[model samples]
Target: MSAPPYHPVVPANPADADAIVACWWTLMAVHGPIDGRMYETVPDAQRVYREHVRRQIDASKGVVLVAPTPDEQGIKGYLLGGLGQRSKVYAVREVGMIFDVAVHPDHRRQGVGEALVQAALRRFRLRGLSDVQVTWSPENRLAHGFWQKMGFAPLLIEAYRKL
Candidate 1:
């Protein structure tokens, strides 16, 4: 079968914030079922996320990449990446963090996600970063497998409990 045509991943602008937030909610829908406590969506998640996405787009150390739908009227996926620093004790100073990534259901398995990841990796490399990190819910099997397939391994495990 022929693969669906997809647009090249490109840097996002303020105009893309709404689409990215829509993609984020799509991610939450999948994850909320995996861990309700951790993925709880607030009543104003859309508004909050829209603001956050706009900030990320304007952040000097951040990169937001999006894959536009074939018609170019909307986005099929997005990736949020940024540069971060480890504690002074850690030798790795500058690290690339893949803050969030999501692809609409219709575009899944069509290379949209991978393309976003590869584009982010290239941006990190160009920025001289050798280490990158991403976090995902352990029970989100799709994310676990996708991140692993992208060559990311577990480096930290966050534990939690209700106090």
Candidate 2:
């Protein structure tokens, strides 16, 4: 049989920070064009994303997962999702939110993304969270199809404009 879509995903440790941050940079690069391209070139972009990952790892209300190469040579993918606030417009006090999910460009269509999301869903379910939400730009056709395939419904539309 062909090799599995990815290696076993596990809880990220302090030692995995560098690799994880690198993957975060890759993630930002991939979405930079689709989301907001200008900020992608900012010098401090990596720093900000690094701090964001660190906080997610430390949060008791969230989980950060990684899929490393079987030989541990490098990370193949990473996922970041956790408990987050709901605006006053929503009835729920909090919700399980998947803030980031990305697989290495070379590893796409290999089940890495789906597996990571499944793991995130299990984590949220274990915490008694019934509703899990994933946000993506409508302009991102890949995200539109993937999130929908993952059972995400479009409930919010956030628009932005430059003056």
lDDT of 1 by residue, 53-117 (tens): 89989999988999998787899899998999888998898999998999998889888999999
Model 2 ranges off by over 4 Å: 1-6, 35-41, 87-91
Error of 2 at 153 (Å): 1.3
Among residues 3 or more apart in sequence or in different chains, the pairs in candidate 1 whose N, CA or C atoms overlap within 3 Å are: none
Q: Name the top lDDT candidate.
A: 1
Q: Where's the lowest-lDDT run of ten residues in candidate 2?
A: 34-43
Best by TM-score: 1
Q: How many clashing residue pairs are found in candidate 2?
A: 0
Q: What's the lDDT for residue 29 in model 1?
A: 88
Worst 10 residues of 1 by lDDT: 2-11
Clash pairs (backbone) in predicted model 2: none
